[model samples]
Target chain A: MNAVRRRALLAVPVAAAVARDVAAQPAVEEDFAAAERAILAGRTPVAGGIAIDMPQLSENGNSVDLAIKVESAMTATDHVTAIHILAEKNPVPRVARFALSPRAGRAEVATRIRLATTQTILVLAETSTGQVHRASRDVIVILGACVDGG
Target chain B: MIGRPAAALLACAALGTLAAASEIRPSRDFLSPELRAQQDDPSRHPGWLWVEEGEALWRRGEASCQSCHGDIAGMAGVAARYPAVAADGVLLNLEGRIERCRTQHQAQRAFGYESEPLLSLTAAVALRSRGMPVSVAVDGPAAPFVEAGRRFYETRQGQLNLACTQCHDENAGRRLRGDVISNGLGTGYPAYRLEWNALGSLHRRLRACSLGVRATQFDFGSPEYLALELYLASRANGLPIEAPGLRR
Candidate 1:
């Protein structure tokens, strides 16, 4: 595309914004409990403390950035102890397991991950009390859009 | 002449191994002929936005790519021999290297592999290397890296159960859905994407495939990605590097 034509297409940021947002919608996970069960394997499910930040949609499945931040005081009584990341639909339910301490300062660790397909990404946070929190995101990968090349 | 039979056998084995290693593959079938042909025409109608972004950033570095090259047109053939071991001795592909430059030079956080900035910047750099033959040296430490990369390309991943070579190598130019599968080559990245209406990196392209096969993705700077890049550079050893090229 020439400079002039591209300028014309991008002139409308609203449409561009809509398209961008629409393309990034997250995937849906059909089964979370089963996935959680596999990852936890003999562990117990807890309540109200984990939040997963997933985009509404992902145009690409490879290297989608994932981050988890749990609300914690960082004191012995309420610090986040560990974080577990899971991909509900992937052959391997476990994505990554993170160990944490009050010294971590915050209940946060960020990394990019490959999404096998459009699926639910779940994050489980275990607080110092063993209290658990969970959050989920739906990600999607547009088929045939993988190798756009020149 | 009566030779040492056992020694001759070992020598024969070594020679066979070298022959196999040096054997070159034909290029992967590019996308549909229509798409493959349009990849280089800047004035080609109905362009890819990712390619556009790449072009924009190349001439005027996007915030992520700002001034990394210092002097453009002067640093020729730089992208062709990438996935090189950095000063820290860590290997990085063009995309990973771009992110390094993005963070260190622009003081901006790096984009995820799927992010537009990641793709566009890569495309921009690829465009710079347009027409330069891929000439990565696999001697010394680089050889091991390429070997690791080759394994990754052939390995199966995720529930979908697929290896990259399944479609790219065995079924090049085959049709899947409405698109034709190209040989999974990375020759013209920082490519313009018609679907995305933008320019993107080969890394972004790789990530997109991983997603399609339902495999978990690695980070942009992860060793795995670098390994894959090493393989890609090795695979396209003779193809011209055409970064920031257009695609669909």
Candidate 2:
């Protein structure tokens, strides 16, 4: 009986073994938490002024468009610091960030991101004022998308 | 030409089917080895400025982009098909598309829908897809999204205003204020738009359209913008994906 059981356990699927071998994957990324902590901790980015925008719901949960706009006068004294795109459910949390200056003309950037599942996306900005302005939005993703009504 | 709505659709069923078939399939294979080589090979890299800029941005962290998406490729080819409709039946471009992500789960602000910073990162991410043919699934109740997008493409917007057709179709390859107007292809976007001094999103590109027409800029993440993105994405159909593309 022991010999037979040993053979069955040895034949267990590779995926199952691997699943048990490694730490269970967190559904969302890690710095996703750390980034949040850093900004909320009142640490200002070198440059301040940021904005975040996104859809209320991601029906596909795959490719999600995102943008950030920082409030700035575009003056040397008061210029946009940076724009960062952060996500919760992707394998890596921070999607992308852009550093802006007076020459940048606008304290903003536009881009697309791959969202693994519906999760929080944060945009943080550091302004010349030693102030950090942040904007956030909630995204709802419908699993097994029936949005197309097909 | 008038008939019951249902009957009209049924009568035009074959035509719709043909259009559908044509809309989704690009003439060229998206992932051909030749194209892929031109897309991601860093040494043969046609545009290092974008990569260089992106890399510097990557390091500026705690709040840097890398803090979120480390090594874009580790995530795979998912970047290829986007600005797609969601399963919940909402048509979202990459920008206005993921609200649940930004606020609820990540406890972070969402990137502004179709704003400048978003364009830079989206372009950066898309560039990683270099050579991948643009592909968007025209599935779900997405048919309406597609149709709306198509209509928006042909419809006129803006003051000194223009339809995409005026330039892309009629004057393709012609200079517009000293710029060579290519086929209005979506092949390369989150592209480095020189005028903008940074990368631009297709919705922002359309916003420039409204500006040209002297129309008010649509609020970011509006239905009008979504429709336009869908249309533009469809237009790039067979063109090789050249995202985070460098443009004059």
Clashes of 1: 42
TM-score of 2: 0.47
lDDT tens digits, residue span B85-180, model 2: 666877765555434445554565766765444554555556666676556655446567767877776777655456766766666555543234
Q: Each candidate: how many clashes?
A: 42, 72
Could you tell me how far off, in angstroms, the CA of residue B124 lies in candidate 2 after the best superposition?
3.1
TM value for model 1: 0.51
Provide all candidates' interface root-mean-square deviations. 11.1, 22.4
lDDT of 1 by residue, B50-162 (tens): 54665566556465243545545544677787867777777877767777776787777777675766666565556567787776766456768877987998898867788
TM-score of each: 0.51, 0.47
Put down candidate 2 lDDT per residue, A27-115, tens digits, no spaces: 66476778667655757444334556666754334344566777678798987676667777556677787888788888878776656
**Best-fitting candidate, scored by DockQ:** 1
Report the error of model 1 at residue B27, Å. 6.4
